[model samples]
Target: MTPQQYHVIALSSLGGAVAAGISDNDLGAISGYSLLSDNATLHAALWYPGSTSAIDLGTLGGVNSAVEWPNHALGEVVGISQTSQIDPLKEQWSCSYPAGSGFLPYTGQECRGFVSRFNRMRQLGTLGGNNSFATGSNIFGEVVGWAETSKRDPTCVAPQVLGFEAVRWGLEGDAHALPPLGQDPASAATAINDVGSVVGISGLCQNAVGALSAEHIVLWKDGIPHQLPTLGGSAWNTPMMLNDEGAVVGFSDRPGDNNGNNFNGHAFLWTSRNGTTDLGTLAGDAVSYAYSINNRNQIVGQSCTPGCASSRAFLYQHGTMYDLNTLLDSSSAGYSLIFANDISDEGTITGLAVSGAGSILAFRLVPNGGWSGSTMGASREGRSLPFRLRAGSFGRIMPNLTH
Candidate 1:
């Protein structure tokens, strides 16, 4: 398939929207966040295949909502939406803001994981706490993510004494707390396969921000947690997405002292056959992350230099990670494709793209030719690196649209 010109999604009239995740199937749904005309509040949005205007998934009564990960099938999406209740503790629960610019800042409020059905948002209750986040769902309608618990823990950093646990939610909103490795105070299940296997992080409750500085990558099979090895670092051992075949991909620190930051790790793929394989960064770039993995094991994320000031989107397949900028058409100058979030089985990618003048818009790239080597290659890194990081949504922000 030859690469075709990418299409920009139309989410807002003011043009500050970003697409964070896409469904795993070919021509799957697209989800993200966008500001209303006044830009006072944000809303989780879903777009049907080939549609430009987004369907606003209203909040659970609060002013903001975000879709981070949608199911590979239709009529299913998992994300965080705020409720009408105000946060009495004034805590900054980690999953509040998103990556990149052109979005509102974090305003902490009571939020929870939600599943939208027939145009209504249903809250997935926490393990006695007030906040929960749903990151991914399987075809069976089971959801996997993290949720706050009732008890306060001593290991927590300031302002975040409550503990959280990786959980699996059934179709009926029943919460099943996935076991953590040892006595770690927090765990977060980021992705689940169709067979009910889960993948996420197990770590100390450093700041109640879920699994930051995660001690180990954990995979749950039949409700048992198995520890996965890292790249020899102590933090940022994250597992982002899982394919149906049980292969998982994410980012991990490579024996560095980046203080457990996700921005300091290299993208990695894990399978039973090969274990964890490090997907190296673009030429001269220091960091990379794999946020979404399709059924074919094609991975998409971002690679950036130190501090993540300048980054480029990358697609990894067949042992090579290619910078997505080189794959763009010659007519599409003045645009830096940064932070590719998801890739469908058909090789359709969605993420944020910034123009030369610094305007941010959501873009989609469709493969005109199959997964053969396209224009993206290692030789194209010499172009001026103008990419700058805009703080984007936390966890997985996916959108769902229903008529």
Candidate 2:
């Protein structure tokens, strides 16, 4: 028997008519999204998450900015805002609003030279070097990423230089940079769990005068960096996301994987019980990269399959890997599932689906219930009626689309 069908709920329009005329715009071309409430109305997008539909978190005069959903929190989103058009320095914005409105600023101006708003984009400010980037945010609004600091050292021949370190940000205090691992020149914190653990990559500067292949996976707890041993490799090992239970997922290369210019990397999962477990690639393929992990320990990423046209999205659960396309309703045309960015505790997933126009559209997969059969038939059955999850709660039942 075929797996149960899942309904594709349109959460936002990234490039539709409502989003046109927005300069250099991509509407709901969501890179990441999180459901704040099962009600579906209360959620966060990587960009604007509101009714007007095209209101982006105004950038620092730059054409590009990113929005990410903050875990399970309602009405909160975080992203990087470029501060200037001439000298664009990425600043972190912690955006929050009343339970039902669009995002409004919640923090002061903190400039970090470069930033990547991934996972849960709460800004993790700089150590002392005037630069920081955020990767993830936990339920309490705490954030983890990396920062740069100014350092004076006798080993340095010239003036005092800047150094990079992992960092954590929370309501308890100012942003604090996690300590470095050994003599590695730079370290970055990528993802954080609800209990406050963090993970990322650490490595020496990659250049002629400072070139050294010393990258390793590092974990941080209470603002301290602890090196996580690699799968016997030299180039670099990067951790992407961590679940609430402290299980971390990422990718690493083997010793012989990269010789001269050839490179080979494999996805891996790490936990306290198991140091690191390799998540092999699809049939006859060579490389894989894991990006996100849900609370149920289900891993979502992309892998190259032999004879396949390109890398496709995949979900690994119960020790089995399945192509994400298998979950979609094949009867629907123009729907091409791509990366699965984040999944909620309820098994709902948010990711991008490419249309025939090559535009990326954000989608939310909810249980295939509510309305089924023909649109008019379901509406006549009162199936389009909105159901509230709590007593004294109210919701707007969207009009059934006549198709």
Best lDDT among the predictions, by candidate number: 1
State each model's CA lDDT, in order.
0.70, 0.48
lDDT digits (tens) for residues 1-403 of candidate 1: 3333443332232233333434434545677666555444567767667765667878898877776653554577677887888767665565553211212235667778888866688999999887888888877788988888888867777666578899999878999999789877789898897778899999887765533537789999998999998887777788888888888898888775456654457889999999999898988888778888888888898887765656778888788887787776555666777678888877788776666665555666666453334444334542233322233332222221110
User: What tens-digit string does per-residue lDDT give for candidate 2 at 1-403?
Assistant: 1223455544454333111111001122233322222223122234333332323333443333344322332343444443333212222222211112112221333333222333322333456554455556666666666555665322322211345566677654277776657876666676777788888776653310111223678888876778886667665477778888988887676677452133466778988998898898766556666767877897766565321224545567777766665555544344555445555555555555555555334555543542243321110100111121110100101111121
Which residues of candidate 1, in runs, are more than 4 Å off? 1-27, 97-104, 210-213, 261-263, 331-333, 356-358, 370-389, 392-403
C-alpha positional error of residue 223 in candidate 2 after TM-score superposition, expressed in Å: 2.7
Window of ten residues with lowest summed lDDT in model 1: 394-403
Give candidate 2 regions above 4 Å deviation.
1-5, 10-55, 68-74, 85-124, 152-161, 207-214, 259-261, 305-309, 331-333, 367-403
